[model samples]
Target: MMQLQAEDFGSWDNPALDRATWMDIGDNCGELDVAIHRAAARGDVAELSRLLDTPHDINARCSSENSALHWAIVADKTEAVRFLLSRGADPSLRGRGGSDGREGDDAALCAARFERVSVMEVLIASGVGIYSETLGFAVISKNMDMIRLLVGTMRYDFTDMPRLQALEGILPAAVRTWSLESVQYLMEELKYDASTISTNNQGVLNLALLAIFNQEDVHDQLVETESDKDWGVAIQIIQLLVAAGASVNAVDDWVARTPLHFALQLQYPPSELIDYLLVHNADVNVPNHMGRTPFFQLLTRSDATEEMVRRFQRLGGSLDVMDDEKNTPLHLVKRPEIASLLLVSGADPASKNKYGQTPLHQASCVGDIGVIAQLLDYGADIEAKDSSGQTPLLAAMSYARCSGFWEKDTRTINFLLERGANVAAFNRDGQSATQLIDLKGYHINNLGKLALKVGHHVRQTQDNREEENVVDLW
Candidate 1:
């Protein structure tokens, strides 16, 4: 649920809307340089010449401390920019940065943002300095002409202090555009390494692979009926990055999750994305920091495929890999098909998690009767005990008290009774299934009836066994 704004960089049509929403007429503009600023905005060089008597008037600050030069650059008035620069207008003044930005951008950065190549040329001629951040603005905005002016204007020793840092940093921002041109420009033209990481320790390849998810905090984009994400350009973007030397197994610093993990954890995982990563020799069962493998995440989804399980297994996916909680992938099985798949793939049905809960215990809590049947078929002990000494049947009964229709299924008790779950079983808490149901007014008539039926069945089976062992005089 980490809120991500990865698409905020490239979803803009107007340059002004993208960067200068802060210049929306703040307090105190009475002594405004209205005439000069208007002339610059109109690209009126003659009017600019007529109004300017000295440097004070020519470089006067307007809304947000933006000068006539900044206004002219934003308006794409190249000739007016030249006229102002001739009158000694300083191009280094920075306006007050809007929200979501730092202390504002310089005239050089502003021009780069609007893609004013000629105006930037004029600024360069007037001794205005370019920066690594300026190149960032050009790359993120997808302005090729501005990119050319900056890169071509100065043989910017791309290896220098800030330029190298800037180029490396732009890799993630380029990925944010979800556009090939943006990312390709950096990797191919600017020579930014495909392996570069953002400041948050996310590798470029990891960011690219995760672009299919467009959520902030809510995963509304992932609430799919049957995997609706197009991923046409998105997958290709990831492919391009991988081809450019991005590592397929790039792991994050936070959770140690590789791209394969992302593909598996989120819903509607693109088959192409999974196959592409596998083809690149991504570690098949690379566990996250908590020991949850991509395979573990895969089975959590209801849509897990047989081929997907086999593909991961063929690549060395471990079926019984235990997480930090000591729960194996099979221990969290939610579907009968998946349970059968994991069991056939060599999962340990009797394996215990940290709480001593087996797969049967987990199935009992969720009340998935199908999964219970599958686990029992695969040799899950019906009488298995957890740390509480609770049998699977007891675990199921206790879980019904788990508040409001969750963590226990009402249907499971019936199935377990049919499977002959022992009613004589008692947990370490000294509570049998019937005692548990009556503990806190949680007992319902249906469960009480089922409990009585199980007790009668147990006694009936005991009497049958006693009769078989008796001397048959007849």
Candidate 2:
């Protein structure tokens, strides 16, 4: 005899049959009833019929508290399900020990989960309560038929705030599953407010942005490929929501990021989509919770394009907008091309961030020699001191020393020196650039040697100038 075990459940939360229930049932149940449970799970109509001929507990729950009807529905045993229902099996009885546990799911939920529409009809006709959680499961499953059955037949109040909240909980899942039809039904038929913000303060627009962001992250992990079907669905959903009056300016309550902020951060943001939002009057300069404008966010992305940057500019994005750190678009420049574009667009090269660090100071920290050169060409202060009193040259040397990328560091250091960085200047800690390098145990590199010689000459010149001033004073 092949005895069934929990592993036979296959992907079900509770794999093993409940031993205690089995033991109790085995002591009382006849061999025929046991065979009936097995027959129901396997969808053996003939075996079920043979067992049904004799007296049996039609709604007999097994060790897991799952009646034979639950088993039939879970296994998509349509015929067996009909027979069990005809025999007065209780469809409303909840399954006890599955993944969701005793209070989690009923036969209706199992039918919906497995997409057993016929079985679902039987359960619904038998008067099962469609709870909000059940609706959530259906929404997340993206089974339009099940969702329709629950909403249309069961008369679930889609206008109820609790139900709308439930729908919100599954928005991400719906997007992932490409449940466009289900979303349309909710928005069009139920008149669910597409712009209504959820308890988390995210509206449909914000959710769509989050979906695109997640898709981009997934794209990063996978090899480049063709446009995903889900991407198409996402674009369509955004279009549908926008046409239905979803706000393009909807900001998340927590991060306060408008949809525009997310659109610009996409790895390969669709130009048309961006333009659509802009045409709809999406604010390009609205700051988020971090006080970062969409333009500021764009600078943080290495993939930002000249055309994208230009579009924001033409739409009145301020080049000098500062983030919470007071870093302007120029201060956050990661690419030389972006730096050039910003400078041409009137970004002040000498503008300092909250930390008093100039664009040149930022370029040094990232070892972008090209951006450093570009800023200097535009007359950025080479010897500007940040709040810590570390000049651009000192910033470059400190970053290089800590980063362990000696070659790039050496190139950046040598570049700064040739561009008139003051090597003898001391930071707030009273440590000159050479002294800082010595503290890092790397006082003998090419840049270090140059700094020492330059420091001696600059210090001597400073002394001479001071003496000249003293004689004048006397």
Over the stretch 348-427, how does candidate 2's per-residue lDDT look in tens digits? 99888888899899999888888898999888988888988899988887677669887787667667776667667887
Candidate 1 lDDT: 0.68
lDDT by residue (170-202, candidate 1, tens digit) is: 667666566676676666654545456443433
TM-score of 1: 0.77
Candidate 2 clashing pairs, residues 3+ apart or interchain? 6-15, 6-16
Compare the candidates by TM-score and give the number of the best one. Answer: 1
In model 2, the Cα lDDT at residue 48 comes to: 83
Q: Model 2, residue 190: what's the lDDT?
A: 35
- Superposed Cα deviation of residue 130, candidate 1 (Å): 2.8
